[model samples]
Target: MKKLQVLYIAAFFAVCLVPFVGMAVTGQESSSENRTLAEFPQLKTEEGINVQWLNDAGEYFQDHFAFRNELVTANALINGKILGTSTASGVIQGTDGWLYYKDSLEDYLGENLLKDRSLYNISHILSLMQEYLAEKNVQFAFTVAPNKNSLYDENMPYYDSYKVSDNKNLINLQKYLKNENVSYVDLYEPLAKADEILYHKRDSHWNNKGAACASDFLLEGLGKEHESYTDETYTVKTDFTGDLDEMLYPLATTPEDEIYYDRQTTFAYVGEVGSNFDPRITTVNPVKTGSLVMYRDSFGNALLPFMADAYGNAYFSRGIPYQLTDVDTMVADTVVVERAERFLPEMAESAPVMPAPERTVSTGEDKADPEAVKDLEIITQGNYLKISGRIAEKYLDTESRIYVRTDGDKVYEAFPNDVTLDDGSTDCGGFTLYLPVGTATEKGNLEILTGNDESADIIFAKD
Candidate 1:
């Protein structure tokens, strides 16, 4: 009995020690979490002893331990196959093996819709961008890529118990854009009416086929003549790995079907090419004529090949606070802004980096109410002076246009945008304008003005 107990104890100790022994021999495993793994914890730092060493060590071990991927795969399999749920926080397992990105769930359920002001702000931002591009004779069009679940809700797990709103951010934003006369492409209806499945079952984004459809719509909207690719032949290859699949089962192989076009590509990379997610990528087509500058996000990955093929020179960027100056530099014939439906709020979160359009607002009676405008900030960014602040919500309406007056002489219209404060909080009443630094003196008194002639003086000192 004593020998049997000793053997059991030895087996338990060996099992517990295996990870440590294997880690020493094999080193840290590569992470599949779609994020940078925590580094090894250091006990000391330049400042002093590391106060968070214990917590950091725990995170490091959790990320680098031996058999981590295998164990994670096993756990995911049990949860997904047996319990019918996802183990990864960022992924949601749906019916028929469909996987949806969790970040898009709010849009799927019609929850957390953007406020009316935000919708107007989005439209105003696009309108300003359109006006700027139009000055350079560059046609501008904007479109939102429908969320995977928004179009494929039939495959999504039943959320009928949740309170779904009739008004969605995408639908409302489209209405505002239409009212503002901003060139906007309606991608949702066309994508929804398509007979074939355009999105990957296990991926958050649409497949190449969907991207082709969007590219056609965008090109048509811009009034640019380009290849429709309607009759292009493609082969369905079953070797595509999905990001969601990799996240859920790091050690498992589950390849999805990818439609690979058989046609030869006409465009070539302008320089050393990285992955699709690079901040900037340039391509050129020797046979094509016009130039294009497109500001896009992840959805642009699939659209890149098609857009590049259609233009003589195409510059695609995923940078935020979009550098609209590219249109001038590229002498672009067309500019397209593509954003995912789920990220609509982001449009109002930051003012795009562009010269504020000069405006002439009638001088209004200066109101002595100090509470009219709050939290004003003036900072220099690039060649422009960024002035942002929040106005009392009571003084503003959907049609109230925001304008900034410098030294009570020059007037510039501001985008009805929100500013992300230092504490990470955002206010819908925020307004931002970027005036050329030389055009506006930083030490001068500024004033906030509304379309209704409401005005309040601003006191600021430049550092």
Candidate 2:
């Protein structure tokens, strides 16, 4: 009995030490996670064993813990079998091993309620883009990619633990867009109307066939000819682990058949580094009929080959701050802004521009004087104007009023929303405010009222 007890004690400590020991033997990065494994924490002279250090150490240890991947997979299995939920991550295991992302269900549930101003915001941007392109005699389209849950809501697990917002973001946005005279292609119906499976069983994005479907719709909608792809040329491989599957079970995952389109059917490009974001693609032998400048995301990856064949010169960029900054460089006949549905709010926010660390500071000494509010970027979102930047920490009182002076001394209040403390790289926090609807004019200036005695002007230009 004594020997048995001793052996049991030894086993427990061995099991406990195994992770630390194996961590030393393993590589510094995880193949499954596709990220660098945590390094041993360096001692900070100033921080010295504070909450920050301890928290960071805990994260680093957890990240580098040996056998962590195996343990996570095991936990996922146990949770799926027993709890009927994924506690390991936000991955949702659905009917017949169809995994879905938690964000999809959250968006469908309206957990992250897109504000009404967001509709006005996107429509305004699209209208501006359309008008700009029209001036250059360039056709433009804002193609909204359909959300996965929007189509396959039945596949999602039925459990409502979040506050659902009553905003029908898409319907409301579409109605507003039409009123604003912004041209766009709606892929939701066309994708749904198709008889064949358009989306992958395991991934958030659509499969090759779905891309083909969307591409076909876009070509027809834009008045371009559709290129044919025969099944004899394409190949299919089965049981591929997808993006959602990586979240749920990264190790030894199950498979689904992936269709690969023919690779031989596209044009090559001659390019210069126009943006630090993507090396701008210009075809070697330009086509006569059309040219394109496309701002796209991951779903656009599948559309690339199809688009390359159709356009003479095509420039594809995944850059944020979706602007006309690259217009003169590409000289395209068509301008396309393609966004995944969930990120519609991004249409309002301009891409952030920050100077180098040395240039970020003011030239004079004692530049950190307390001010009521420091304005950052300002742009119009139709009737509402959004002002974002930092506000003095002391003046961050919930009731502080920021307003705009429009139509010659007419005062309109700006309501702040989604303000976050310690958001930017500074002691002061950041805020976003939408000037109330119907307060806009052809040209006007905004201001912040700092108590009764003082006010600061906010200057902004759409260009």
Candidate 3:
């Protein structure tokens, strides 16, 4: 009987080993696949372009990350973790030597991805804004925010450093904009040179200390005077870790840390709010009670309010382009599009390609070819106006209709609903939308959509 029992136990153990062996093989294959580099001819530098091991590392570290603060019911799970901490403060050691408050996704990708398309799209959009502003006789200026990693590259592990210099998209973009005579504030070199501590050692974002420095520089660039807001006036928010710390090394043990912010302050900004799926304006006054519209992303949150106090209004947003159509509707005077360097390329690709240039409309009745309808041009009484252009082409077999939507009002208005420009004389199709003089102007949003999948937003304003 003892011998039989031993055999049964042995068989069970052997069965368990089968699954483990299969898992090991599968995991190894996945890792090997990850190490393989993606082929892209345009990229000038591919040295650290592929880090296949990052996903596996992220998965392993995710289990030990702690969440805290029940700021809202939606964040209850995190709140529970915060409540579990001793004195509402918890600490975790990191793969990076320094102690930090918590982890943040914004920090993770900001550090990991060097060339982002979002920034490129922002540049294109800025170009469009420049053209639009120029036609309106308004001046335009732009700034791109640097990430914590860019600010503290040397402090990070040697293997994790990003070579910002050789990044093709960023390099090309900066050159292109400079050549075009676009006015911009270069924060990366300044922060790197100033040896300023823009980000928290533990958290993924800049402290009020760092934000103050940036705000001062921005004011100087804008030809505005700097104001006084010292460290003494700021408060240290204790026991908080950001997204990167959560992702990189959660299980490692470390000491507690704090993040600083300007506690008592107010700001004013004007920008659109809410998603196109759900549109609304959201406002906040972190220091003093008041309202400010903010056009922002993660980078904007830290710096906006401080600058908001300097302006009569501030506008912020989370980088969802569909919602951007409402930009003019927010009654914003100055629009600041903030993004980390990595996101530029994607934004450029995603922008609506210049619609096929408008074709000349021929009045067949006259033996002469009619002149082409030029780009849409509008004049507003309040000194605020938006001019949009697109390339439109239509094929004969497939009846195509280009639609324009403003705010949530579908096809709020359009020039020509169904028009074909297939014939060679008119190139088969085209339309130029223009808001006539004395048109009712209000804060509104606009987007061009065809079917479910094809859509792009054109954020505009009218006085």
Candidate 4:
């Protein structure tokens, strides 16, 4: 009789606890059935205390509360793929541990998820762009940001195997672009050699040092050059933990967040919309930052400042949409397109059909030696600039003249006789000409006239 009484009391307690368990899981007020706890459902008049119900129809409730929802199923599905496998990072263990592969799955992503040889067709796409832009006389340049894994793959426990001699995934794109006659900038080689910590020991994005190196490489490749420094004051914060460390190595590694190296004098955006330059939106205020858009990826955040000083303004933005809504109105004449190698194919495909660059417009006054003048070249370094080409000195002394302008400036300059004029095989005007590295214009129009004073107007940008 006593045992029967105990069982009856236990059954009573279990029945009483069911509602409490339901409340804990669904977080709904005992009376409410249409709202979810996360939605913070409350009686309209009450500010703090409110009913939390499980809404059967709302998206949020459907997502979190739905037992068979796709998202939950996806997580479980991914987990199940490696349910019994040991994690590459030994610390994480479980039949479900294989789901952790998401973090390091980029190596296999190309073949497994992304289309195969997508980059191969990128060259063809670029060629089409070149052909299309040629009609407009616009020159197209391609840049690709290298994957951090491409540089630090050695640290990874496993890598995807692809059949190609250039083990570095980024290098393959470079060869393809070259063969297609697409001018591309290489940041990987320089950044890899730089003596700075370019990335956090655990994070996927580059550290400030690495971004700066990449920016410098980009500037140099774009014909805008800058010097290197041992240390730059990037922002330093210790309270940062990266995604990888958050997941696999939770307590193992603590990472720091850093921005640019030194304090930069910010510049106001001259053409940006109302208060778009507000510092409240970004860590740094725009009015004081340098001039130049350091077009970059997550890795580009660190590198933009390195090149910002050279321009009147510098900005950093991602390339996904590749659309700067106001860029068409902000600045015109020159646009520097930068991207990592892995992203090049996509960048090239989506690249807008830019107008053809007007190399030699019909200036009306056309004079030339019966021979075509040797190729005139303008070399622009950050500090020094030079224009060199082979032209008939005799013609230059008389009918020939060198006309140079920058950014459409009317200021004309005389050709320096100091240039060595020697053409191995003179097809015309003069032989090859060598000019000092200091004579090129910074940002503006430049022209080199061979025989007649009339010149082919060319735009020159500083490196």
lDDT, model 4: 0.43
* TM-score for each of the candidates: 0.93, 0.72, 0.48, 0.47
Candidate 2 clash pair list: 239-255, 239-256, 240-256, 287-312
Highest lDDT: which candidate? 1
Relative to the true structure, candidate 1 has a C-alpha RMSD (angstroms) of 2.5
Candidate 4 or 3, higher lDDT: 4
C-alpha lDDT of residue 126 in model 1: 94
Q: lDDT score, residue 283, model 1?
A: 91
Clashing pairs in 1: none
Q: Look at candidate 3 and tell me the lDDT of residue 299.
A: 62
Model 1, C-alpha of 352: deviation from truth (Å)? 0.9
User: How accurate locally, in lDDT, is each candidate?
Assistant: 0.84, 0.62, 0.43, 0.43
Task: Residues 247-351, candidate 1: write the lDDT tens digits.
Answer: 888888488999888888899998887887788999999999999999999999998999999999999999998988888888888999999988888988878
Residue-level lDDT of model 4, residues 170-241, one tens digit each, is: 545556667668767776677677665566654556666666666666666666545555455556666555
Candidate 4 local Cα displacement, residue 336, angstroms: 3.3
Error of 3 at 228 (Å): 4.5
Query: Judged by TM-score, which candidate is best?
Result: 1
Better of 2 and 3 by TM-score: 2
Q: Which stretches of candidate 1 lie over 4 Å from their true place?
A: 1-10, 159-163, 420-425, 452-463
